[model samples]
Target: MREARPLPQYLVQRYHGWRATAFVENRVWYRRLADDGQHPRAMVIACCDSRVHVTSIFGADTGEFFIHRNIANLVPPYAPDGEQHGTSAAVEYAVNTLKVAHIVVVGHTNCGGVQGCHAMCSGHAPELEEKSSFVGRWMDILRPGYERVTPLPPEQQIRELERQAVLISLENLMTFPFVKMAVESGNLSLHGVLHDIAEGMLEQYDHQAGGFAPIV
Candidate 1:
């Protein structure tokens, strides 16, 4: 095992990370003290990949948004069952508990899960026999997005697929009871966003236009 080293040189001016209380400091502790009482204005459902951090991308100030992360940021269609449904539960909580005014599903370019799903859609993978593996199943969420973007060229297809996945996840969000209720009551709004890490660009879904437009 690696030995515990002293704090890195970057800690010079900074006494400690947790010691300085940002808006999010001790939030989990607050949650422990029955302070989990829903107050965030937005809920972001995003990918677990390091590159897809919505907090950093959106400049979220911690308590401003509730967040849920998953393998690919895809929300599966509603199905009442005993399956592991943490993402769905978080959505429920944000709508039912936090009563967040907005819900955003963020997807990014060059996502490994998206690439793997694209490969699977192209029928080029050699491991179809054991399709129950983690990535294989995770990519299943992208199946429909893959089909929709098939006609575009390779590069364009990827861009379109990423956009479509965000839309699909947004649609999936509406399938939940709490989300639907919030939408119907005009208390919640849904959005889909695409993050271009390479270009440092963020695009918001223009549902009427049916395409992503730069946020700025």
Candidate 2:
């Protein structure tokens, strides 16, 4: 095993500050949460982008959401091949164990992952095409999305691809038998949304509308 060093001074200081203020201010709530265990009502599958603050965006409090983040917020098709699947594991726990009523897939504008997919699909990103590149393989999940938006202008295609990320994840979530059963039996619902980072706006997917509409 590699020898590990302590946390950087800035992060350590920030943690201390949070411990002193936020933790102290909500000590009772924190303790109660610990004693009761979590009962979050929703499971949020979001991107690993630091700029997208899931809690802040939803104004969520502690234990309000069970969040799973990964590159591009991609959820691969359900495959029960005896292999490690972090995202699938999280989804299974959330739906079957936690019984969350809502599963929300959140994608954001100007997503680097989406951009990389566009580049790779357009045959521009050779580095990401390597078989050994984990990122390349992961972004492959969104290739269909890229293909869907190919006829559009460059800027429009990128924006639509971001929304497609959320849509694709929502579709993949249903590929899980448990998720499909839960939805079919009225125990769970799936949702998709795109967050416009610079504009501070959110557009939700409306099945009836067949596209994303701003959250009024």
Candidate 3:
């Protein structure tokens, strides 16, 4: 096996500083969490964008949320084929093993993944259409979302597609039999959220209203 390179000095220093402060401030809580396995009540599926800070937005504590990050925060339709599926694996563990009470699919404004999907679908990004592109394949999950938002003007398409990403994920999550059963039996609930990075605002999809409403 090849030896791994050491972390950069700056990152090492920052980690040490954070570790000291975190342990000093919440020693007991951290210890208890280590002793007892995590029992998070919610599973947050969020985009892999650095600007989208799920824990910070919710002020969540350690062991509070079981988080899964992927391109566009997409949850593809439930596929039971004997294939390697990272997102499905996470969903299964969170829903069946962890038994989370809630699942939140969080998308954000100016998402690169969503934009890439839009570009690919619109025949603007030919490079992403290749079979060898992992990103292209991953972004395919948002293709359906892009199609739904195509009717709007080009200027308004991106934001709408971003919101659609969350909605698509929420809808796809229910395709899992366990998720459907849980929701029907009142054991689980699903939510879709869109975060605006520039405005620091959140919009939640209202199933009853059939639209995204800003969080006041």
**Where does model 3 exceed 4 Å of error?**
none
Residue pairs that clash (backbone atoms under 3 angstroms), model 2: none
lDDT (CA) per prediction: 0.80, 0.95, 0.94
How many angstroms is residue 100 displaced in model 3 relative to the true structure, after the best TM-score fit? 0.7
**lDDT, candidate 1, 25-49, per-residue tens:** 7666556546554467999988788
C-alpha RMSD values across all candidates: 4.4, 0.9, 1.0
Q: Please give the range of 10 consecutive residues that has the lowest summed lDDT in model 2.
A: 1-10
Clashing pairs in 3: none
Task: Give me the displacement of residue 9 in model 3, in angstroms.
Answer: 0.9
- What is the C-alpha local distance difference test score of candidate 1? 0.80
Look at candidate 1 and give me any clashing residue pairs: none
Question: What is the descending lDDT order?
Answer: 2, 3, 1
